[model samples]
Target: MRKLLVTLVLILTGTAAYLWFEPEDNPDALQTDQELLPDYVAENITRTLYNEEGYRADSVTAVRLEHFELLGFTQFEQPVYTLFNEAFQPSWKASSKYAIWFPQDKIILEQQVVIESLLQNELVERIETDTLEMLFPDNRLQNNQPVYIQGKGFYIEGIGLQADLTEKTLQLVQHQKTVYRNED
Candidate 1:
C-alpha cells in the first residue's frame, strides 16, 4: 500500500510539473497592432532607406528577419555596375566582376571589386581586394583591404584606402608598401 501511494504521488508531481513549465501559446496571436516591423521600414515608408542603380549580378542572395533587419548574403555579377545610396545618386561601374553587398554588419563589396567614377570631364579608377565597407553619412569609402587606384592625374597601389570623393583625396594606408606615379 505504501508503494502504491508513493507511485500515485510521483504521477501527480509529474503532471503538476508539466502543467507549470510547459510553454504557453499566445491567445491574442492574430492582433495586427502587435506585429513587429523593421527599423528601416518603421522609420519612414515614404523615405527610402537604400537605393541601387544599373545593378546586375550573376546570382543574388538576400536574407532578412521578420523584423526587416538585413542578416547575410553572397552574390556574383558579370559586367556589374551599380550606384548605392539613399537615392542612388552616385555611381560605380565596372566591365567585368563588380561589387558585393554584405548585409550582416555593413555593406561589403567582395571579389574582383572594381569601381569607376565619371564626373564631368574627369575619371577615377579603383581596383582592390574584394572587400569594401561603405560610409553612409559622408558617401565615402572605408576599406582596409589592399587597393590599386588610378585617377585623372596619378596612380596609387597600396594596402588600405579611405577615399573621400568630395575632398578629392584618397587616403592611402601607411606601413604597407605604397607606389604612386604621377602622370602629367
Candidate 2:
C-alpha cells in the first residue's frame, strides 16, 4: 500500500510540473485569432450638423446607419439619407423632423417627414409617411405608408412602393389621389 501511494503521488506531481512549466508549448499557441462579424445594423437614428457640402449641393436630412462593422482596424459606418432632393445646390439648407435606423437585415421608418428642394426658380417637395422599410446590401426600400409628392406640375399620393435609391427610381401605387394647381 505504501509503494502504491508513493507511485501515485509521483505521477500526480510530475503531471502538475509538466503542465505548469512546459515551455508553454508554442508561444503562438496561446494567441487567439479574431474574426469580424458578418454584418451589423442600427435603428431609430438621427444625425445633425451645421451643414453638409457636396460638389453641387449642401443639404441636410434624416440619416440612418445600417449594416456596419467595427472590428480589426476598420470602421464601418453607412449613412442613409432620406429627405427631399438629395441633389441640391451648395446653398441648400433645411431641418429634419424625423428619422430612423435599421439593421442590415431590417429597417423601418414611420412618422411625419418632409423634404423640400429649392432650385433656380422653383421648389420641389416630397412628403413621405413615417413608415418605411429598407433591406441592406441590396438597398431595397419599401414604403407601404401613404406618400405625397409634389413637383412643378405633378402631385401624387398613394401607397405600396418599391424604391431603389441607388438607382434613383421610385415605383409607387397611387390610391384615391388628386393633382391640381399649386397655389404656392
Candidate 3:
C-alpha cells in the first residue's frame, strides 16, 4: 500500500513540474507559419528528356504538378510518359492518375497505371497495374502489384514485372498466367 502511494505521488509531481515548465505555443504564430509555407505550382507541364546521343529519350506531360519549396519534391496529376527507341521512334508509353518523383529519376506511379508498347510492325500490348516504379535514364520499369497484360488474341496475368525499356526487355515475376491463340 505504501509503495503504491509513493509511486503515485512521484508521477503526479513529475507531471506537475512538466506542466509548469512547458513552453506555450502561440496559435496566431502557428497559423502564420502555415500560411507562410511556400509552394511551387504549375499546370500543363511538358518535360522532355534526352539521351547521350542528343536524341529525345523520354517525354512527359502532366495536367497539374505542385511541389512545396520546403518539401523538395512533390505530387503530380495525370502524368503521361513516353519513351523513345534508338531510331528516335516511340517505343513505349505510360500514364498514371498520380505520381511522386524523386530527384534520382525514380517515379512511383499510383492509381490505374498503364503501359503500352509502341514498337513498329509488332504486336501491340497494353499492361496495367495499380502501382509501378520507373527509373528514368536507366529505362527501368517495375511493379509490385497485380499486372494485367492484354494484346491481340492473348491475355497475360502476373503479380509483378521488371522491364528494361532501353533494351526493350520485360521479365514477369510471381504468379504468372499467359494465354495465346494458335491461329494456325
lDDT of each: 0.51, 0.49, 0.85
Give a tens-digit lDDT track for model 1, residues 89-166.
544443234333455433455667666764445456655556776554354677887777766566666788787654
Query: 1-184, model 2: which lDDT tens digit per residue?
Result: 9999999999999999989987744544433221333254444455443325533222223333333243322121333343333443332222223333433344454454443433454433454565666554344567677877666777778787786643656778767575767632
Largest lDDT belongs to which candidate?
3
- Give the per-residue Cα lDDT of candidate 1 at 137: 38
lDDT of 1: 0.51
Q: If the candidates were sorted by their TM-score against the true structure, best first, what order would they fall in?
A: 3, 1, 2
| lDDT tens digits by residue: candidate 3, 47-149 | 9988787899889899999875555566789999998888899888899999988877899999999988887554537889999999977889898789988
Give per-model CA RMSD: 9.4, 9.9, 8.3
Error of 3 at 89 (Å): 1.3
**Residue runs of model 2 more than 4 Å from their true location after superposition:** 1-100, 115-124, 135-140, 182-184
Query: Which residue ranges in model 3 land beyond 4 Å of their true spot?
Result: 1-22, 26-38, 182-184
Error of 1 at 107 (Å): 1.2
Please tell me which model should have the higher lDDT, number 1 or number 2. 1
TM-score of each: 0.45, 0.41, 0.75
TM-score of 2: 0.41
